[model samples]
Structure formats: C-alpha cells, structure tokens
Target: MPHPRRTVMAVTSASLVALATLAATGSPAHAVDDPPSTPVPITTPDGALFSYVVNADTRQHTAAVKRAVRHAGGVVVQAWPQIGVVVAQSTNGDFRSDVLAGADGARVESVGATRTVPVSEGTPGSGGTTAYAEEKASGAGRTFDGSLVGATVADPREGEQWDMAMIKADQAHAVTDGRKGVVVGVLDSGIDVTHPDLAGQVDLDKSVNCSDAGKVDESLAGKTSLSGTHGTHVAGTIAAARNGIGIVGVAPGVTLASVKVVNDDGFIYPEYAVCGFMWAGLEGMDVTNNSYYVDPFEYYCEDQPDQYAAKEAVRRAVAFSTARGVVHAAAAGNSGTDLDTNTTDDTSPDDSTPVTRTINNGCHDIPTELPGVVTVSAIDQAGLLAPFSNRGLEAIDVAAPGRRILSTVIGGGYGLLSGTSMASPHVAGVLALMKSQHPTWSPAQLVAAVRAQADDHACADVTGAPCVGTDADNSYYGEGVVDALGAVS
Candidate 1:
C-alpha cells in the first residue's frame, strides 16, 4: 500500500512450507482434556449418520486415530494429518467415547461431533479422494494485473456504493486497484460465478464445496438455499471487477476464491469451516474473509470437552493457514451484544431447539475470536456503529461500513445487505491492497499497519450501549473505521 516493492510469497508450493510443521506441533494444552461423556446431547438417532472430528495428539499419530475411528464403526471421510484432524461419519451414538477409549485411544487427543444434526449430505465414499489433489493441480482462480490503462475505473452502478466512499476505497482506487495475484478466499455460502460482475473475478479451480463433511468438490455450485446470496455479496465487496456493467469492489484488481462452507440449511458447521481454512492454505490464498460463525453454537467454551475439541480442530486448521502466510478477517457477529463481557447464550445448538444457557468468560465466537484473525464490526453510512453489530473492547480489531451496502447479489444483479458480514470483506480488500503493495510483509506487519492507519474516532452514542475506551480504541469501533485510502497510501 505504501508503493513499496519487497519480497513475495508468490506460488503455492513456495507458500506451503509449514503445513507439516503445523501438524507436527503437539496438541495444545487445552485439547488434552479427560474423556468426554458418551452420546453427547443432541447426538444422531441410531443408524442416522453424524459427522465428527477425531483429533490425535500430532500428525504422526493420525494413523492410530484413524484406526480408532474405524473400530468405533465410523468411516473416515477425510484425514488431515497436517492438523491431526479427521472428518468422519458414524451411525454409532457412542462413537465419540468409543474412539477415545480403546488401545489406540491414548494416541488421540480428543474426539467431537461437529454438529447437532444428523448428516444431511450423506457419508463418504472413495470418490472424493482425489478432489483436493486434482484441484490443487488444475490451477488458481482469476486475478487482475493491476492495469488501469484501458479499464473503466468508474463502474456503471458505483454511484450507488456509499460504502466505498465511507471507507475511502474510492480514493485508494486512484492509487492502484490492487495486485495481480492476491487471492482472497470467501468462506461462506457459495458465490455465483456466473454473475456478470463476478464471472471474471472468481477462481473456479480454487473454489470448492466443503459443506459435505469437509470433502472437496470441484464441481462447486451456488448456495443450496433460495435465500443464500451471502457469499456472492461479500465477494463483490472484495474484488468484483471494475467493468462498466455493474458496481465495483474495494480492491477490484484482486481475485476471489469461493470456498463454500455453508450448508443447505444455512449453517456453517465446524468441519466445513476447518475445511475452508485448510483449503485456503493449500491453495495459496493471500487472505480469507469469514462472515459467519460456526453453527449450532454462538459460543464455544473451553471447559466443555466436546465444544473445546471441535473448536480446537478448527483452530488448528486456521493455524495451518496462518503459518502459510494467509491473513484472515472475520465478522464479530450480528447479535448486538458485548463479546468482551459475554454472559448468556440463547442461540446455541441452532440445528435443534435452542435454550438460554448461562455463559461466562470461557465462551467464545470461533474464527473471529481465534488468534491472528482481524475481527471487524459494522457501521452505517453516517459513520455510526450499527446497532446489530457485536461490540467488544477485547474482541474487535476494526470497524467498516456494513449497513445497506450495495453489491452483487445472486440473480445476476445487485442488492443491498447489512450486518458485520458485509463489513469484513472491506477489511479483506484493504488487506489485499496492502499485500499487493508490500508483498513480503509478514501478516503481523500488515495487521499492525492497518490498525495504525485506521481513521480513529470516539465511540458512537447512537446505540445507547455503553462505549468503553478512548477515541483511539473503543469497544464499539475497535481501532476505528477501516481506512482504505490510508491503507494503500
């Protein structure tokens, strides 16, 4: 962003030196808990398949864990030795306990059923065995060369993009649209590549459907639900082309990888999320934007063994991405509450009946709350914090224009959507610009620069919610509203 030239993490193989290293790291202390209860609440009905994550202590011990999974009548769908995580399906209600109690049990760290509902996508066969390998070998998605010589800078519908002006993306665009190779993975509902504005932006080879037990499907399609345009909307905000046909994105010169993690029921399960993150690293993504939290639980607590194990598996997958130099940005949430002083959760086990369970400091929002991820909150056109955004003096890393954002929707058209989900892509776009400018900068350096360059402001009094901290840093605004122009200048 500073118009500086530096070293580059250019290619996929060159980008992936430490996937094995991340897998080699012994299990985290938090994952080494005692045996959890068998037949965890909300388990599948007998003979009904449920997806689970079986984690071993390290990559070297994954074989034993795989054997344990088979012994418990579960079929290993996919085994990620790099993260010591195995995505499996089982009809046995006691698979969770049985997998961690036999002779090979000591080699395993923890086992967890990733969701509350029975498998809707069905169990694994051997067809998906080469999907990931084939995808990696096929090629990457589309990327811009940052050339504006004959390109139209102003899109036909850009007049409707107030969010761009709010974040100063308009000013940044004059400096540079972005770079040629930066790929931002959109981990959400599947993005529609056929959309006029996104056809040239989405990387089809890099995109995959992870909703089916973390299996990689090369023939990826759009969202299964009629109401699912979330991924395409977020992609438009990040890198929709600057063609005359439609609205432009914040970093129109970058590329997008549509990593579908949301299911037909509109849920983002832990296994899907883990697969998305891992795919980002394996595919050599520069950044990833997570607009939703893991399903069924608004908060995954460290004390709950099942929750902890599932969360830990996801964490390991994210760590693998980070180690490969992938920067991550995530939405804080739309619950309209303080994540710093979390109290109660009435939205857990969303696949089933939700109960108002008392929560505490041990609880957390996955991905957004995970280490090394930039947590963003939502704001409106007036520069006021969105009332529905989750605020936190501890959790939030930045703020961005989110409410009533105009971007590409599913019907090969444009629409307005809100929530922190819309805000995160703006940050991801800014990060892409930063990477394009300073290709060799470490992820930490980029994050620090983004924060330091933010437009700091006092907390908004509009929400009537308590605003803590000074203008420089506050619960409602984090460092402040993300400054696109500043990030690139």
Candidate 2:
C-alpha cells in the first residue's frame, strides 16, 4: 500500500504578509464563517449524515445536554462529563441548528462533525519487504550467538533488527528487559493477539474497538478481519516477546493493550479517536503511540468554527489523558514539509470534496501539534532525515529510525515498512522502558528525559540544500535520535 501524502502548499513572503495583516485586522472576506443560509438543509459532503462533538458549558448539566441532543433529532452516543464533551449522531439535515434551538439556554460551547482521518500507510521502496530482503542479505541477519551486550538474546530474528540496535535498545535490554506491569496502548488499526511474537504480552482486558459511535466492542479489537497489518506491526515493535520465534521488541517485558480506532476502510473518525484517548486515561495506560493523522483537515485552523470544534474536542481528550498520566507520542507526518512555516492545504474536508486554503502557524495537525504530546520525526539507518518525514522545530521532539524497519505483521508474518509511523513506536517503546524503570516519573519528566538523552545529530546537507537547526535540537532531527540505553539507565 502506498502511504498517503499530506497535502501542503509552499507559502511566499507575500502570502505571509497578507496573513499577518489579516490576523491584525480581521478574517479575510473569503474566509467562511457561517454555513450557507439556504433552507434546502445542508448535509455532510457525503449526504444525509450528521455527527457532532458537543462541548457543554461548565454550568450546564450533561443530562440536560443529552435531552437537548435527543430533542434535536440526534442521539447522545457518549457523554464524557469529565471533559464536558458529548458525542452525538443524527440523520436530520438541520441537526446543528435544531440542537441549538432545542437546547435553548443549555450552554453549548461548540458543536461540529466528527472529522475523519485516513490511514497513514508506508511509502514504497523507502521501507517494506524489499528493503528487508536487502538488509537480510547484507549480513544483517548474522547470528548473535544468544548474547548481546552481556544479555542472552533469544529471538531468532533479533539479529535482523537494525532499528533496535540503532537506538541501542539491544544494549539496553541487558540492563532491564522492562517491567511487565507497564501498559502501552497501541491506538491504530488493531493488533493480532494470536501472533507468537505478541501472545502473552497483549492486555486483552483493556483492549476495545471504538469504531462504532457508542459501543465498546472487544471483538473489533485486533487485526482488521480484512488484511490490515499496521497495528500488529506496531504492537510487535513495542512488546513482542523474547520467545526465540520471531523478534524481540524494545521493551519485551511490557504489556500492550489495543485501543482499535481505525475502521475497515482504514479511516479514523474523531469520535473513535476521542474514545480511545479517554479510555486510555480511564484505564491508566502508561503510554500511547499514534501513527496516523486526524483528517478532514490536515491543519485545523482556530478561526474556522467547524475546524476549531474538532480540534478543541481532540485537545480536551488529550488534555484529560495527560492529566491522568498517559504519555502520548505521535508521528510528525509524511508530508515532508516544514510545519513551523506558512503553508496551504488542498486536502481538507476530505469526507467530501477538498478545497485549497492558505494556513499559517495558527492552524495545526491535531494531537501531534497539541500541547504535551511528544512529536517524533523519522531518521534513516544512516541517521539522516527520511525523505518523506515532516519537519518543524516547534513540533518535532525527537527522531528515530523509521526507514526499512522490520517487525511482526498479521498472520504470524514478519515484514518491513517505513514512515514517521514506523519511527513513533521506537520512541513509544523507549517510553515504556523509562516508565518501567521510573514508575513515578510524570509525562513531562519522561519527555524531558527522552529529549535530554537523545544522541545529537547536526543538520544534514540534502539535495544541495542545508538542513535547518543546530546539533542540540533541529527541525530535521529534533533532539536527535532516541536512545533506549540512555532511557533505561
């Protein structure tokens, strides 16, 4: 499968000045504030579907909001009183307007559709089966004779795991394999619990699929019944067991819980994402790895009410999760553009037709650019930035090996894949180790430790253009490559 390229626009100095002027004054005349006023009744780009994330004012009772939602021809899917947010769905065309009218003084802070995010697949030739074969043939499969850095390594394919070695996780394992009690949530397509490499390490009790609006179905958790391998691969990278069968993960002794949020079509809706994060907090998950971008818009701008509501819902969920002690890690993106600068997006409102619009720093990639999340970029085996990895000094926190990485896939199979998606798990696995070694550390402390311990890489010269930032911290390499040994020690 080809990785979905993030839609981006290069901004000129003129656009930047225009945006600054617009910011100082008011929104541009072309900016959209209200939906069309026609009584024809507007449906989603996909016709007749209505879903919303409604934030209740602090003074309003959640039960009253539920009644309002019902009166407006919508059903309250879930009521998260902790964050004052509610997920609702309706088939009525005038659902938003009706909800407001029915609620009257119920204090609805915001209401918008549950946006959609497409699956972020790996790009071909960057990493996949072909790269796996070449690395295997180039002596990467050399036997370790059951010992590495003074520890007995049992997994047969551990020798082929160049990514683990690159981050010194193989050496770190000698110090501590990890504590079993620490749970890392894999929020992606789903995991394959039956895989030998991940058998005993998966926490089934905490796993749930939030694909449906109001249900928590465990049966939906795990590999997609229709050939999805992303989640299984991610799980293996975090806690694949040391059973001498496939490969060992960075933190082999930790537990993995699947919070399946993506659907069969590989799209992650905002409702599912909100549920996953909220669940992680309630379940006391120590960490989570998010490799996909939330969609409908790549960069949700605050000035746009529709986009702002979606961003606010996600932000509240993440904030709730963070306050409850979940360390969140996410991929920067595969766009290969600088996130700190002005850019235009041509792929937003993806649930329907996309329209090109200019965006500045005011707009952001949800969860990644959100506060307190550890944003990670991708580096190749040679410690250089991956050609497709997103870069931003303000957004990226660390870099990890993502190119041509190998791990467990569906059906007890092993394969290679690449992307910033591949890089995120390396950092997640390291966080698991850090959590195991220092259970009392808060999420902020863990993030600081990871950044402080990363191996500093100076900016690289790419395609006759010099990379940005210094060796200590740069847009391309962040705080440099993640070091598992440093994390564990």
How close is each model in CA RMSD to the real structure?
A: 9.8, 7.6
Minimal lDDT window, size 10, model 2:
33-42
**Best-fitting candidate, measured by TM-score?**
1
Please list the residue runs of candidate 2 whose C-alpha ends up more than 4 Å from where it truly belongs after superposition: 1-42, 45-47, 104-106, 116-151, 219-227, 464-466
- For model 2 the TM-score comes to 0.83
Model 1, position 294, has a per-residue lDDT of 87
Off by over 4 Å in 1: 1-40, 121-150, 220-227
lDDT of 2 by residue, 1-489 (tens): 211112112244644554454333322211232122111112443235566877665524566767777887777888888887788877666666566567442456566666432122212222111111212111122222332322355677888899999999999998888898999999887887767677677788888887666346667423233226787777888888776667889999899988877665556667777888988999999999988777556777655555656777788889999999999989888777778763667655555555777775347787788888899998898888888788876668999988888888767778888888888899999999999999999999999999999999899855533467788998888898999999988
Name the candidate that leads on lDDT.
1
Clashes of each: 3, 0
- Cα displacement (Å) at residue 412, model 2: 0.5
lDDT of 2 at 216: 60
Supply the global lDDT for candidate 1. Answer: 0.77
